[model samples]
Target: MRYRTQAVAYPYWVVALLLYGLQMVFGLLAIVKYLGPDPIRAVLPFDVSKAIHTNLLIVWVLTGFMGAAYWLVPEESRTELYSPRLAYWQLGLFTAAGVTAVVGYLFRWTAGNKLLEQPYPVKLAIVVVMLMFLYNVGMTIWRARRLTTTEGVLVAGLAGAAVLYLPALLEFDNYTVSIFYRWWTVHLWVEGVWEMIQGGLLAYLLIRLSGADREVMEKWLYVIVGLTFISGILGTAHHYFWIGVPAYWLPIGGIFSALEPLAFLAMAVYAYAATRRSGLAHPNRMAVHWTIGSVIYSAFGAGILGLAHTWPSVNRWTHGTMITAMHGHMAFFGAYVMIVLAVVTYAAPILFGRPHEEHETAIGLWAFWLQIAGMFGMTMAFATAGISQTYLERIIGLGYLETQQKIQVHFLMLLATGILFAAGVALYIYDFFFLVPRGHREPTPWPAAEPVEA
Candidate 1:
């Protein structure tokens, strides 16, 4: 089938890698704006840097999701995509739209929301591109030869792409409505759609890498997807707690948000048990490491820190502070970004017809550690800064600007941590693009021997 070939997946990987690199660059610029002198702020405005950071993040995640779709759709459907040409067109449109939107934001054309700041036209273009992609993927699945795996997960992710955009499209002139729509996009994408994608991709990877029965993995996939949707839809209420929504939302959001981590934990246990019992035919250490990191960080960041702010009492103090940002960065990067990277790593070797170089794998693993450590360090520093600033401003009645100056030192620490993250990204990009092995390698035959368990 045409989809069985690497050509369908190669372009997705290329775009993902490029966007990943750009995300890191923007990350560094954002850090510079936060830490560097006022002169640096003039060159790289905070709004521009923030827009770049958020937009780059969205681009990389989408790129990775596209690659995962290309890789998994063929295997699950047992058929080639209905039209690779349509996929190419989707890619072209999305790339053009993403680039144009980011440029527009940097040039000051924006909607003014923190994460949803792209210009109106750019937002419309994004919606159109998403629709095109949805149509192409939907058609491919419709014409598929089979649906042996968890089609629900795939459909859920696609549905999320559209559903999450609904609130943004709602015409409401009020800032409250704007905030509601913003969270609809933000919370649903991270806690809902991304989770579905992660579940589907993980199921596919587990089946391939662990040599586990597809049926068993598919069942686990159903459970994962079920939990994600059930929890995610209600969990969005957590963000509503401080947003001037109905007071009744607090309990609903907190309860569901608290249950969200259980899904990831279950996934971890399932992977470990499956691998241990089935005997991994291809125990890709890099992939395993990334997957494990994703679960651990998500559980801690989203589950634990998320619970910390679920209460209105706590959120009243923590909302809009660096503490919230700290939680968001770790949870999103760990849950979504790492899962995407794992899928890419798993599929890249198969598509390339060779294992990635051992050194490259090592580099990726090292980058994983660096990013986790750097993010942890930044989160701790920011949390401390946030609490201290809050107490100084609210409790001690310090001036807002004075409180900011007081926290400036902590931002310095955040900058240093960001540099470490940037270095790790550099290593990741270098290893993934320039150093990983490519093309076929001659198989090394072994003498006849007894059958091994693996």
Candidate 2:
């Protein structure tokens, strides 16, 4: 079968492949710096590599969301994208701006605000790109008249993305005030907006893969979004403790952030329940692997480990240490990045009009397991290092510099784990792009929908 390159799935594969490649390269660079000598850090500084790592993550995930939206929206609404040309333009502009911003960060041009450090102009460019994307998606939704569960979630995410930027763009002198709202952007977007996007995409995937009832999946979507907002909005307080905020914020943040994990837990249960209720033969085994893996890992890694640091007592020791990275890496990967990858896997064969090779699916599944194992190993090593550093710095009255030196071996272990992750990523890229079944001229028949249990 000759699969059309312009199919809805093509954009997703393009974005996923590009991001995976960048992620492997920069992810390796990050690991190498910590394991290598001081001179190596000079060549590839922490700040630069961190910027590349985080931004690549953000851009690629958003690109996946875009592709998902483009594919799912039209299918659900029974209409073509309102403007493919606009989408293409948005993609081109975003790619250019993202590259420019990454380059600027690599050379030390930044706003110096941790996650929000991209320079002013770059931030402005991001905002513009987002607005353009919003316009395109919004118009598509309007023209379609028929709204799906996923469309609602996607719109909500886009709205949250727009609103989250308000505080970062505001002029503020007091770092405390700036930091407070910074979490609104960082925390809210991840816990709130990204959660919505994940929920929507997961629902769409389940509908396709499991032949699950759209109504049931839609209800799950509402519950997920409701829990996310209820828990996630107040959850922003978790970051307030160390940022010179009121002492009262500690308890509020701790309690609400603790509740945030419940949403994820519910999502995992719901996905499993729905899939089991619908007795369908999933066409893509790798999609099932990724979907189930994402939900389970998010529940354990994001929910369980995240709860460990939500309290003031535990957080007091965990803050500014490798422990936080453990949570961030696992949670983000499990909750958001994995969902995006799953969506790509689910959509790719349909977009290409071909059945993916079983061997390739098996390879991708192995790569998934390896990546998860690597992340788990790295997080454990970091947690150990963080606790050791905390004891040395706080209990033993050792200097910060001395404590870092004391945990050098743990950092080396983290570097090794990162290498494992890179290897996993390499396998994934090969399995998806190079090794997967492709280049079909005939359209494959859509799989029969199985019965859905009441």
Question: Compared with the true structure, what per-residue lDDT tens digits does model 2 show for residues 325-415?
Answer: 8788889888887887887777666655565444336678778888888888888887888789878997788998888888889988888
List candidate 2 stretches off by more than 4 Å: 1-9, 356-360, 442-454
Candidate 1 matches the true fold with a TM-score of 0.90
Instruction: Name the regions of candidate 1 deviating beyond 4 angstroms.
Output: 1-6, 279-283, 356-361, 437-454
Candidate 1 local lDDT, 134-228, one digit each (tens): 77667777887466555558656866877687667655778777787788788888888878887777776666657677777887887877887
Report, for every candidate in turn, its global Cα lDDT versus the true structure: 0.73, 0.77
As a whole number from 0 to 100, the lDDT of residue 86 in candidate 2 is 77
Which one wins on TM-score? 2
